[model samples]
Target: MTEKNYLTQKFEADRSRLRGVAYRMLGSLPEAEDAVQEAWLRLSRADTSGVDNLSAWLTTVTSRVCLDMLRSKKSRREDALLEGGPEPSVSGEDAIERETILADSVGLALLVVLQSLNPAERIAFVLHDLFDMPFEQIAPIVDRTPDAARQLASRARRRVRGGDVLDTAQTAQKSVVDAFLLASRTGDMAGLMAVLDPSVTVRVDAFAGGGQSRELQGADTVANFYNGLAQTARTALVDGAIGAVVAPLGKLYVVLDIRIENGKVVEITAVGDPDRLASAEVSVV
Candidate 1:
């Protein structure tokens, strides 16, 4: 058999798995098929002489294609948002057929949650958690370190489980926040960094800062902001989410609305406005 023939046969053999990966990444039959086709086109044009595992290489290529499509879709959605109107919807027989295909392939609830996640998080979570792909494999695809890739999947996992996290996941989140509080109290920069997402963001309301509302981004910046602070902060459940609160002499002074993903702190909102504080249901954990 010719080399081209052999390659074609191998690709055909892996087509099912590739389609599955793309479908999960995109959550749309048409887009997934397009991504798979793109992968095949790229494979036909590239040098596969050094590739030891054709299946793995194909999976990676297909995943990359899906990621690009997802990013482009996200960009367009953002543009639509700025334009101030909702995008038109599809309907009739075509829409029904598409919906039937998707519903048969994936659970509606899971699909809804997956659609809520960002492109990178969706790819990481679907690949690692769903396809059993490793973080080492996912890291390069998402342009992140292995640890960060792991965190990406971790964050996605939490979101998939929804707002009322399972006891185990909630316990895990609490530990991360507790460590963060310890690090903050002791001015431990490295400790804080360890539990914080690389792109963590912190926003403080005017009431929280006595008149100046501000936002901080990046782990280093957030860690710096928290270093040597929160000495009186207590671990609390902010609206059923594990967070921290500062109440001196039994009067609520500030509430830290911490959001954790994949065992790391991703976002923190400090609320100090009396009206805001009055509405939030907070209790020390």
Candidate 2:
């Protein structure tokens, strides 16, 4: 077999894993795809005659591409907010899985919450903590001392594990989601209010952007948000689940996740566009 054939075979074998890592790191399917494509272009141009580990080289390239994208996206979000524009909607199946994993994976959540670090730190923490890559290997990838990478990972762990409220908060969040949906579809505002904490927060991720900027604190505010929705939109209980999609007249408007805590509603997070909605199990008419 020719050298080109060997490289092609190796790339085909590792494509899925590369895509998975890129997806997890970037959280957007399209972004991940773009990152991987760029990585492939870099690989095609590299002098592979002496390269011993093609997989590692491809992964390193992919990681750098993803890190660049994340940094660019972060800056864009900051600029958009400054200009009074809405935050960019989370797009693609990869993003959906990232949100679900962040909510569900104990280790993944810890790494995600450490986004305050520089890209190097974030990459080190994810590699060491989540993927179990050795500090020595990670050091080359991030161009840091192995000892420094170890320290970064340790600091990230401490920062994430410091919070003891994760367990209770997650449980309360799930309950809140279930109850709020139930009450909204049944027109049981009282029931909805019952699950909500008095100091609840309600925010809508609207498409026209900047729909509701202020935090809707208190049960009354939460109840009123739903009341306005009910008045302007029609809602139907998504069969087989405790969630609803609110459509304006006949158009799909928002997909809502209701959170209940201690049998009381505590939070309502609304995604106004189907494209932006992370939770997929919605019954759309």
Candidate 3:
């Protein structure tokens, strides 16, 4: 094959992997594709005669693109934001199976936390923890030393690990989360009513829907909606508090950040934004 053809073939092989990295970094499918295409553009224009590892180079370039995109997200996120279509209804065994598959991927709560991170921390964590890249190589992408990169990953790791809710001492909070999960998984309306306060409120992030479900209120209103619908949810610590994480296959799909008072759930905030979900730390049940 000619030199140009050889380069094209090599880049195509790495495109999917590069796209995965960008998706994890940006949390948006369209943006991830953009980043990957940008990497292709850079590769097309640059000289790689001395490059030892094409995969590594592509990852760095894609990461840089995502970092720039993330840095500029404040203005872009509002305009480009989108969420899943209306949540599909599943019953009995179907819900269980769907949850299991989704859990196998990244948990939604974790994504929320990842989104909360600065560009450097996000890239450092995604490369080192998710993609298994070495800090030595990750350092340059974030303009940090290898040691600094390692520290960034460490901080991100610590946050990913469960927090105070992991403590057995927080029994009351745990009980609330447990009740919520049991009710959700069992589709028990009575159980939901028993645990939720009369004035309970449920609010999902804007990406969930800029309208109606944006804010669902009243214990009956919220419980009626959630009852028998969260078959995949499990008790977990979300951001140091007791709550539920919907991850059937171990990947985060949604984070139910709950607030309980007097042994009853008073508030539940569901965050579905991928960038925000990356930052949430959900404890294993």
Candidate 4:
């Protein structure tokens, strides 16, 4: 086979693995495809005669594309920026089915926890822990020394494993989270208030669809926001803290990262960002 044909054949062979890496790095399907396509584009245009491993080269390129996309997602005007591209030929239902399978395969709770991490930390952790790449290879991709990259992965590992050993304090916190979720699901205003500090706060990230990040202070305001809302929310552990995951029809909609102090919930952060969610390690309570 000619070099051109040979390259095309090899790329097709590596596509699935590359897509998996991109998807883990970017929780959104469309974004992951875009990252992979960008990698293919680079491979097609660049010289690879001296490259030792085509798969490794492609992974690095895809990772850099994903990292850039993750960093830019915050400043983008809308999710529609991704939607503006040529629509995939697949039918809508087929697309949904594929997404559902992918989400299940990757685990929504894990995605939610990954979303809580910073971009560098998420990349380091995913590459090192999930993909089995070494820190030496990850260091340049994240613009850090090998040791620094190791530190980043180490920190991410701790956060991923943070909720594993729940001590007395965590147990009590879980009770508080359970109470809050039950009350919210049942629409029990009084019960919800009982578990919330008078000075409780709720912060919703912009990805939750208000066009901006929102904050609600005081028990009354926070309780009102959650009232009649968590009907579909289920109890879960988010980064070792008692929290809730709102996954309707098996697709993760939101993650409520809760914090409790002195037996009452003091803070709640609701996140819907896909990339951030991809980094989190969540589990059923």
The number of the candidate with the highest TM-score is 3
Better of 2 and 4 by lDDT: 4
Write candidate 4's Cα lDDT for 47-121 as tens digits.
Answer: 999999999999899898889988987312222322222223334787667666776676665665566678899
CA deviation > 4 Å runs, candidate 1: 74-102, 163-285
Per-prediction TM-score to the true structure, in the order listed: 0.51, 0.53, 0.65, 0.62
Candidate number with the higher lDDT (1 or 2): 1
In order, candidate lDDTs are: 0.77, 0.58, 0.73, 0.78
What are the per-residue Cα lDDT tens digits for candidate 2 across 159-264? Answer: 5444233355554454555455557656787876777789888766655235644457888877766652443222222322344455332234565555555666
**Quick one: how many clashes does candidate 2 have?**
11
- Distance (Å) between predicted and true CA of 97, model 1? 6.2
* RMSD to truth, every model: 17.3, 12.1, 8.9, 8.1
Report how far off residue 206 is in candidate 1 (Å). 38
- Model 4 residue 231 CA deviation (Å) reads 12
TM-score ranking, high to low: 3, 4, 2, 1
* Pairwise TM-score winner, candidates 2 and 4: 4
Error of 1 at 284 (Å): 28
* TM-score for candidate 3, residues paired by index: 0.65
Alpha-carbon deviation at 209 in model 4, angstroms:
14
lDDT of 3 by residue, 145-200 (tens): 99999999888777666532345546778888787878877888899899989988
